[model samples]
Target: MSFILTLANLLSIAAAASGWLKLSDGPWSAREGLMAVEDASGIVMVGGRANLGLAAQHDVWRTPNGSSWERLPDAPFAGRAYHAMLSHGACIFVMGGQTVALLGDPFFNDVWRSCDGGETWDSLGHAPWQPRAGLAVATHNGRMVVAGGCFGSSIGAGRKFLNDVWATRDGASWELLTANASWSARSGPRLVDFNGRLLLLAGEVGFTADTQLGDIWESGDGATWTLLTATPAFSARSGHGVVNAGGSLLLIAGWHDAKCLHDQWLSEDGVVWRMVSNATWACTADACGRFDFWPVATSSGLLLTLGGSNAYSTFGKLWAETWALPLLGGGRPLRGGSVAMH
Candidate 1:
């Protein structure tokens, strides 16, 4: 039987003084599929789908701390969404996403790396994996590992969901660890490096509302995976944010049951989860409560999320509000601010 999460259960562990604190909306316009990672230098965000998913922005943005954000130069590669980005060693790597504009093929398998923050990038050539979007990625065992995504255009035929796994120490070449993972093929799943293992979390099979999953899986090596739970304490979801925050695993907002979710979950191991009460951001606010966004766990004991979209089909609504949740200490109440929508 599944473990049901109730209001009393959520309130029992929720700290009254702790919740999501809204920071100033950064420089970037409202967009979704934008990827961000926290490294030694700071937090760097990359390309996203803007203008109602018709325009893809190649521009990069960075913030040393969440308070201030600066727009970096446009990337060398074409702008795309549903791509994956992560920090490994001294390199920040980006790979595999689809373009919004329907011109030629929309999928991309090319890889690029930035050594000097997001100021500049060098092409690492194409990857071994097929062109895909919404793929899950994480840094594991001093290498970057990528798994599962959707391949095909927004309105094209022959669309395919994948469950393959690949890893690389350098972006130039990739090793296929597994052609098929134990989990079902899905897109927009959350992959994180936690407790010396790679944990894969809930994701969706397609655009259908009922296709979302809440299963959790883990792997020490990219080749083999073990299922931790088929049904978690949280509801089935997709496009959620999963990160390692101060040695603990955190699952943030996502889409579930045809509605945008604003709740947060905490776990020491992938098998058990706890709802972090009062830690959720405001979903009722204008252009708030997003899925398919990136969340980074900083060295400062704070979990940060910047931009994401609400719906799955069109990805029409996007958000730019920056929210920070304190994982270790007390958090302030929700604050109000104007969110600029383009």
Candidate 2:
């Protein structure tokens, strides 16, 4: 009996040391991934393209352990993609993205809030900023700040990119922090609140090849910005996910030069980045190689990534699988170490 107990303990340790675990499949069929957030109750997924027709969806779902999912009612607005979903205090907010249109996709400046943990939503009316999609947003110092995205239809000509910044304490009203910031006009940059400040990572400028950038910027008040590095340690890529794991920040998978990247990086500060993982590449869609998918940092210090897709039918496939990695303890990098997967 003692030997059997010892064997069980060893197995448990080995499972934990495996680095990643594939949890149960999400309820919905794979499509373009949505923005996800974890609150006191559980993790909530909101708004993304559907797998059937590639149309935007307004469905909301929640999960406690990533093994099971509970689908909430549809949101009060039309289906959209590239939107932002964040949890602040007792409420979860969904803001700005483009809606599926037959003629040309129209951008949205609307903001919706759910006070009872995504059970029901109320439109806060349109935000003060212009309608846009692929903007980076995060709650900083008890206020939400939005920065940089592309406006206009992505399919044809006349597309406009922006680098403007705005902030709001409440969802209804907003204040323009800056008309234009130092960073170039871009879309799909990864934004996060780190150490009470806002950090913006790499993003793509125009809808074409050779437009991705690896710049990193920091802002204290969202008005004045500081360029941490014009060129970062990692390659230039858009559609990546960033999370503040403990005091350190982690950058997840994104697309770089037609390749779907599976590499991950970590930084104690925003400037110096170190590659930590080189997982296998899966998707290769030009518009949605895991784009717009948000990674949730759980209460137990484990990071969870839900459904995502590449959006290209041939190369990109929708995913319902859940991936997890433990980020507590000394999971951070020890400065100046060689780039190696953990």
Candidate 3:
């Protein structure tokens, strides 16, 4: 009887603690390619393509508790998608994304910062780096490191991929650490600060090429990068969500092998990875899938995923819905499918 009671208690705790709770659909319509970053205020999502390629958005949305949301004023910068946004100290910086909806040209190198949780913005002007979209940026060792992206349209007209590395202490001034990185020129890879180093992983060359890179690389300074692994256990992918959660690195859903993936991977030293859960917060069937989503780690040990698209076709649908999961130590998911509030 004692064993039964203990088992019952464990089951009850798992029921409440595990699974994903889908929150509000957010202030905007369905959209993809939005930039989201977590700061002291909460989760702030900015700029995305509305309804696939219909129009680009400059609107800003924030949620303090992951359920209730409020729309802030439109960002002072022009509407864009595939931009890089991250928090450094108390300032939130936004930079380097293409304008127009999804298929247009004219990338942006302008930098903007918000001191008040994205309520208002001030222009920091364009940086010395080339204007490009789908770039990766992360704060490392009290400095911001920027690297790799694509220039030109999504459909291959004048498209060019890049592998340069840049860094900035102040948003106004930027320095090119290396004009060419050790990694191949690619776009949309996740650049994350992991284990006191900057880790870059898994992005495609371009939409036209459809070559997804699976290798992993790391760097202490912005200038020199070392390839950690040429092939990881997880398939090569891009548009995946990556976050350093609870002292472990989590790699979430992405596109691979001409289809959207729904697996989750965790790594401690940024080399070997293990899939903790493959059946949580994503579509199990091929009829529905998601990518280009943003996953942010909260202070309370909850992993929140916001805003991604379900399909890549012209009739594809974008999501403004938010999903939350309580993670165990080392960023492991408790149960594969405990509860889904979608």
Candidate that scores best on lDDT = 3
For candidate 3, lDDT tens digit of each residue in 89-156?
89899998876643444689999999899999999988998899889999998889899998865564
Off by over 4 Å in 1: 1-18, 154-157, 283-288, 329-342
Higher-lDDT candidate of 2 and 3: 3
At residue 303, candidate 2 shows an lDDT of: 73
Using TM-score, give the best candidate's number.
3
Candidate 2: worst-modelled 10 consecutive residues by lDDT: 330-339
Task: For candidate 2, write residues 212-305 as lDDT tens digits.
Answer: 8889999999999999999888889887878887888888877677666666788889888877765512222343335445578777666777
C-alpha lDDT of candidate 1 relative to the true structure: 0.78
Model 1 collision count? 0
lDDT of each: 0.78, 0.75, 0.80
Which of candidates 1 and 3 is the stronger one according to lDDT? 3
List, residue by residue over 1-342, the lDDT tens digit for candidate 1: 758954323333332333455565757888788898877778999988887777888988888867678888889899898899988898799999988654587889999999888889998889989899989998899899999999874344467899999999999878999999999998888888888989999988867678899999989998899999998999998878887765667677788877777776667787887665413564453245668777876776566787788875564778787776555532211221122111
Worst 10 residues of 1 by lDDT: 333-342
